[model samples]
Target: MHSSTDTGPDDAVGVGAAVMLVEDDRRVRTAVAAFLRAKGFRVAEYDDGETARRAVLDAMPDVLVLDRMLPGLSGDDLLRDIRTRSDVPVIMLTALGASGHRIDGLELGADDYLAKPFALRELQLRIAKLLRHRASRQSPLAPFTVGRFRIDPSLRRITCDGADVVLSGREYELLLFLLKNPDRVVSRDEMLREVWGWNSGDASTVTVHVRRLREKIEPNPREPEYLRTEWGAGYRFTPSGRSS
Candidate 1:
């Protein structure tokens, strides 16, 4: 469920991002969520991974703060599943001194990892940094080529092999965002903010758009080329349509 409450100060950077927090511990979850809300983010908190897994597919938050030891699906399993279809920037929290856990999380496509007993401020700063990093990769206003797909942001158009490929408003926006971050894994959170102007919403909107986009650009949507899913990460726009 999505709960909207204001916390912190209005002076916090008003990026209006939404954060989904998955933690089994009530105390830790409550404290961290309070801090995030204060930082001017909309937060949806979950106590277990099973419920979160279902909710995330429908209502994908901009960022996910996941704990490794979760009930039901477990953090690592949930992360692995999310990476299959959606690229939502995930920051995983593991036990202190568990180097193996940290390594496993990263290998599973976690954007960042944190040990328990860390400062909330540090988590805040990490989230801000991740958001900034994603923003920094915004594509300039220009036409670009990714494989046979020719994109004209100025014209809001795409063409494959000289044939026009029509896209809906959302489709156009999604494609543009991907093209801008070429060869990089773009989480669903970044897509929602940049393309939909939403701090939080159904992530299936993104999943649908991606499928439609692949239909138009890829030679075969079932076996995609230009738009590929990075397991444990997110979607990537491979410019050459060929894996390097």
Candidate 2:
């Protein structure tokens, strides 16, 4: 494992954020770590999945930048393990840019995906956005009820029918966004911008999260009661469970 820090200007968006970066390529890992450090982030670099996994389980980072292909445990396996334990936002890096591969990563619970040979500046921006979202979730807010679901913002917990419903970080955010805009049709582009903090990205990311969220929150995912798709537009959340 390698680490980098700088006494440089701390005005960057990731100033106080600790970033865990795992990549098999020494050159890439070193370069990415150096770049993030210069941007005011404390970076811990690891060369393989197993080492990174141990470190992550020990102390979760603010954000994780993980390569899809790794030495021992492999990126997919590592991500699976991490998701089972924590909701730390993950940005997956891969050489494959195919839509199917991106979808698979999202299904595995990645918050974001970036193809390799990516610009360092883009990576920095993505990290900054994620950090901003993480910070926002901490703000205190009164708990509210929407249909069968009761949301407690302060605790970041949701319960349905008095039973706790487990949701990933991304899923929680998506559900919160929908709950805030009840009965309104929200486009995929809008969801990407508002929820994922992306100006442009594959819409499948939203679709995958929606599917996962429905599985958790909806009694029948096949016929979702709350989250309804508006064909040709996007999605709508009807807290009353009334069919449109």
Candidate 3:
């Protein structure tokens, strides 16, 4: 519904953050775009997923607000396609507020999800939080050594035994957090808040990410060396592996 050239004022905290909003509903899209623009976010609005997808592939935005249901392409499929190429943070918006739907979105690599009939302020807050977390991760820092693995936050890269290890954005963030708090048991609740920037959500999201991280970083995911579960407590990161 809106052109890619549309931009807001350059003075707010979200001055440089562009939000690509993909929603088929005219009423919802218009209202949401107005609020975001008022808040000083440059917005590129689309009513169909195909156009939105192409736009993002051409030039990824700082964040994406996607609707689960859309014409041309469904949000779920679009999300899957994006995961293979970009790590731009995504927030799913839909009338489907069921827990299963939320879980599916998270599993598909969405950074956040908000049900319809939600507060506009909450959406803005969520976007702000995600951007802040992203900025913090890019802060200059020395490479961290954890056993045979080395993590460079600035470059957003990780290596194991000097070999490159691929990781998703969320996985990288989780690993970085665990590495920073080595030797301590970090509860799932704490992880949700600190690592995911989520005040509350399903604990399984943390579990899923941890499992994926261990698979890539550990010799065996079944019996992880660096990433260990604390059973009733949560998870513990052994910087020096099991030998430590």
Of the candidates shown, which would achieve the greatest lDDT relative to the real structure?
A: 2
TM-score of each: 0.56, 0.92, 0.88
Q: List, residue by residue over 153-234, the lDDT tens digit for candidate 2.
A: 9888888789998888888889888888888999999999998888888889999999999899788999998899999999
Q: lDDT of each model, Cα atoms only?
A: 0.75, 0.87, 0.84
CA RMSD of each candidate after superposition: 10.6, 3.6, 4.6
Q: Write the per-residue lDDT of candidate 1 for residues 1-244, one digit (tens) a residue.
A: 1223433432354258989999999989999998787777888999999999999879887788999999889999998888766666678987753666666775565667788888887687667766664554444567878766788766767787788976644466677677768888988777877765546655555666677778878888999888998776778898678855
Better of 2 and 3 by TM-score: 2
Cα TM-score of candidate 2: 0.92
Which of 1 and 2 is the better model by TM-score?
A: 2
Show pairs that collide, candidate 2.
none
Off by over 4 Å in 2: 1-11
Overlapping backbone residue pairs in candidate 2 total 0
Model 3 root mean square deviation, Cα atoms: 4.6
Report clashes for each candidate as comma-separated counts. 5, 0, 0
Roughly what TM-score does model 1 have, to 2 decimal places? 0.56
